[model samples]
Target chain A: MNPYHILNKLLCEEEELTSEERKAFVEGLKSDPELVRVFTGWLQVHSHLMERLPETKDLILYSLAADGHADDLTHQEASYISDHWKDIDSVVESHPGFKDLTHQIAQDRQDFLDCWGSETASVPQVFRLPAWSYQIAAVIAVLAVAAFATIFLVNYQDRSMQLAIATPGEYQRILLPDSSIAHLSGPATLEYNSERFGRSVQLTGQAFFEISHRPKQFIVRTNEAMVQVLGTRFGMRSGNDMTQVILESGRVQVASNETPPRSIVLAPGQMTDVVKGEAPTPSIDVNIEDELRWTGFVFLRNTPMRKAAVLLSSSRNVNIDVDPLLMRESVTGTFSPDIPIQEVLDALTLTLNAQVIEDEDGFRIVPLFP
Target chain B: MAASKFDPQLVLRAKKGDERSRNVLLERLSVVLERFFKRKIGDQALVDDLIQCTLLRVHSGLIALKHPDKFKAFAMKAALFELHDYYRGRHSMKERSFEPELLPEKNYSINQSSGDSMDVEKALELLKPRTRRILELREHGYKYREIADILNISETAVKMQVKRAFEKMKTIFAD
Candidate 1:
């Protein structure tokens, strides 16, 4: 029942104290000065270990085995505690309180283990986290990942999809809220409410669409052409010289105000290069993913240095100059848009002995060896 | 309400992509952030600006905020981003100026006070695992009685370990 015995049990593996006995000691501490000081000191050590021992648990256990679990008790530790157990033994000969605390701590641990065992052994099945926590964790993780990926896929899809006829302004590819795809071309701007699943767009400069297969109709309309489809791949062009429709796959009946808008069976590999007030002429050899390569891949392996440099310039929307002397070297690497310019330079420097120097305008590649 | 119980429940809801749950977490955490950032950013003006920007990002990006339980670290990172942006934007507008040499190696006044707390943590590390457990329960806002109950040790045992831990801290700090 003595506080010291409880304290000792806590320090040693004496055993867990009963809940009622521990509670009484807590009440006793309010009136005891020595108890207050001792408790505070224990707190200091406890927190210190908790914060640091996360990665050092095994090491501490190893030390425990070596040192017999008794931390080296220096003169200070002795003074801090009984200050020479033998001498204090006579002074505190009547202090039966000390051993009991240590004993209770051990007893309590045993009690806890007993409780843990009963709960565990009674069940034949493996323990699992609470249902709500497991369900919530799974749902939250999936949704959060989906939201992130949606943002990513939508951005990537936007880059690869373009609006046929854009105005003479900054072109932006829009992932229609419905997952239907469209690339904003020319100077025209296309905006989609990604929060909503409606595949509606207003067009200026022409764009193309690989509309996602869905029950809803995907619609794109410009001043010249209004095109509708169930689910198809097609390209439309609106410029000074012409308004054209190129169908890569699926079917689209192209109609326009200026031209007698007629039905076009645009099969695979068909390019409808249309001029306003003229017949729709289908063409060939369309590099769809390649055409949008600027928004897709800035770094290409085994690509000509000059061409890669040009691609990097447009892709990053930064002006970069390559030393003409290194033009003949074939460049090979993969680069993400998020890569820092320094990292890019480091890769080049390591691979080709190429070094990059910087100025206010941009970066210039210079070879260290050549 | 119990701090331990409240934190995990809020964290669970927030992690489950509940925007409201995240808002509650941020609200609970705003107090912690105020304390955390006040310690880091000396200037009151910049601190306020950074806090505002961080909260704005948290609100707009709640659904996008992946780790809801690690709200404290997440918010701190947000503040860091805001600070980076502010300095970058300011650099663009201002003329070139000489910057002061901030030698962190030189121990300052604030370091002295915190240095003790650090010593305390270090000293606690020297104790055996059981002693360490008893000490941690006491520090994490647990009552000696509660710690005894939780760790199944006697209150006196908890007290002894605490005293022993303090002595260790004093020594560690002395070193």
Candidate 2:
């Protein structure tokens, strides 16, 4: 007999498997690493399915029982219920939430019935209007709603805001009305009212913000803390009842969202964290490039090509060799880390009329002609 | 019984671009999928997402289904795919630096507690649909002979599928 058959019989606890076969299967699992791995995998999948997949018959019967319609069960259903009453009862006893599940099922069934209107109902011919009239009425109603919604949305848009969400595996770059830039990491949401514009935004997860200088302070708020900046670049991450703000090139004031909030000002290359219901921690020095790596935005402001290349190579885990003469040349640009390193290098070299060459070890940036 | 209740004629009509039939089919499927998901996962929001994703999968894949009679299996397969994707996402979330505070409390708890193993679900995707069906049925407490009867194949064929599924899983685990 196949080992899987024996395994299946053992899992099912069937008496059909010979004792010798069962012993052999157990012994193989104990002795062979490969067999043990496969068996473990099989068992995991089996348990997961058992836990996730409902026993249709039991579920149907349970729903009926929970709904107080046990009397309506068919003869076969009643027989199965009687035979498996202990198992069914144990399951129901364990999952107290099954009642809510039945209620949800009833609601779902009602929704289905509502969507699938009475197909069996017959309308009197005298009361039936021409199909074209119904269509025309629907079109008119739709137009009226559309017109109203358009006006409402126009007003609502001014008052409420726009929401930008970056799901897992996505990096989104958004430009605020004031020409400020917000680079959102995956699994993050940034919401800001258009009317409020670049002044303030609510953030969840993590984001790097480049704020434009303005009279009104630019603020980023999270559940735990708030960050206020003026014409500065910084990365803010909020989670686990704590918010951390790291200032890169400018100053930022971090404060707890709690009442009587204690605040701390973070200078360039410094970071602070605000725990829930507490004051912001004192600013501590940090490596700005390392801290903001998640945003994948490399901000270079008149930095020499040598330093830029080192930063790029470290951030992207690639070796970049710049030509000797070009090392002293300065590069000024904000590069999105998501773009391929090669593409970014190409674009960067393009500005200097230089070329990028690829080799097995990594990439080398040399003068276009030399 | 759920499979028996699914009308292949409606699926055929939906495949032929019958809007009314498609709407009705999807509505019924939504109820089934909701129940299927709710039983497994307690998060209503995740259940709702799974239902919508599965429905979309079924809708898009409906055109490619050659045998309308296999609609239940097809729909179930779609649901399985969505569920698998959900588990896979949860697994990857563990490997990555996901902000747990961003997830709703209940969903966070569920995600943290489940899919902690080496994830055999990915390996299951390598099996043929028929073989997968047999393995799933067997896992659900159906005997090999019963699964063979349900799929209208011989008992030996069902055993073969089980063996093949395990062999495939073994290779995946080995790697």
Candidate 3:
């Protein structure tokens, strides 16, 4: 008797089995310990599944269009939905019936609000006017508000005062007041003020910038160095003691804030590092894309073990203690920020001929024993 | 359920102040939380907020976690606490129709918690979509007959899919 067959019949089938078939099922489970173990495991899995909820995106959409009170949504949810609105839009757009339904619903914001909003008292007053008349009135009201806001901004507000910050373990992409885009890995901050008309940004930590081309000098100031560009794409990292800049495209000038301050101009595919009170390193050719992996994952190519450790620690924001002797060993491979940290350690151990001890204090990388 | 090879090292690194490891751990567990919350809250928009709250607690409380191998259990406890806190904050307003019978067993043992499901989840990713769906339905307590009806397939097909999914899962968990 096939135990798997009998077990499946017992577990999955709804109909009652014959006396002989039931006998076979019980006999299979009673005789084979492996079958019993598998069956027990399946029961545990079933119990666990019973505790979980199904993924129901379609049902959620149905509820959203029918119920407008999204008080349940936090700020993150709103931003996520707004950012991925195209995905939701695409779904409705692909279907002609949904397209028509959305078009009808969109034209009447009040109708959507009435359906989805938690409040019901306003529905009667909102319905007092005809739909077309209400829409025209709403349009005028919106334009009037927009015109007032525009005048207020032109007359009183500072256009460039804004701050973009990326928190630890996160990435942020912000559009500068000047229309340039800044991508920052966490523990980074970018500050712009109207004093520079948004042309100058003070940066700490690490960031990638795509400056818009303009006659105005777009300057990025770091603790150790300053980057000046008309319009370009670049990546910059400022540590406690040194500042590094890599220009991906266009031209930029890097000025070190040393005692004997020196300025160097850089073209595409060039990188320079500046140390406080010391001259900046000569620009070297590096793949800027490869260096930009702090924002994502990067593969190392013939990188020394010491350098790899430093990169891993920096990227993960973790403390890694490596022996001085193993620092000279070289490793050539890729590292992804997605997998578990042990897997990376295992790979390092295999490649670099090293051993890692993970304890309560931290991870220690040492020379492998014979 | 036993801990898989993936999370313990990441948890160890995370506990040691590795922000990247922490982020990866959160990302993977957030998927699990999303599924958990979606079933409980029945509201998609609310799910993200609960997940964020759970993560905040997890992050703040991770330092106190004594065992790296028990990270999943610790995190899930924080998640359940957040759920309790949310309902308490709402003054016990019933957001949706929920029966106690449908709830997770109150006597659920942390030792027997669904740590193994993470491995099963990974294995399910490798299965055919139909087979995975069949197993998922089964996990949700759907009988083979019901799954067959829902999928418009034969009962034999449902049984075959369940067996195949279990076989694949067994192989994955073995490693």
Model 2 stretches astray by more than 4 angstroms: A1-160, A195-198, A299-334, A338-343, A346-354, A358-362, A367-370, B1-175
Task: Kindly give the number of clashing pairs for every candidate.
Answer: 54, 1, 3
Residue-level error in angstroms, candidate 3, position A167: 13
Lowest lDDT block of 10, candidate 1 chain A: A54-63
Specify the poorest-scoring 10-residue window by lDDT in model 2 chain A: A115-124
DockQ, Cα level, model 1? 0.04
lDDT of 2 at A64: 55
- Which candidate would rank higher by lDDT, 1 or 2? 2
Tens-digit per-residue lDDT, B86-145, candidate 3 = 643542212111223212334322224456666544555677777756655544334554
- Evaluated at residue A86, the lDDT of candidate 2 is 76
Ranking according to TM-score, highest score first: 2, 3, 1
lDDT of 2 by residue, A178-217 (tens): 5567889877999998533547899999888877665668
Considering chain A alone, what is the TM-score of candidate 1?
0.34
Residue B116 lDDT, candidate 1, scale 0-100: 55
Using lDDT, rank the candidates from best to worst: 2, 3, 1
Docking class of 2: incorrect
Report the C-alpha lDDT of model 2 over B13-125, residue by residue, as the tens digit. 99999999899888878877766665444246787899999899999989987778767546654665575456434422110121232223232222223553336556656
Model 1 regions more than 4 Å off: A1-168, A171-175, A179-186, A189-200, A206-219, A223-236, A239-242, A245-271, A276-279, A286-303, A311-319, A323-326, A329-361, A366-370, B1-175
The worst-scoring run of ten residues by lDDT in candidate 1 chain B lies at B93-102
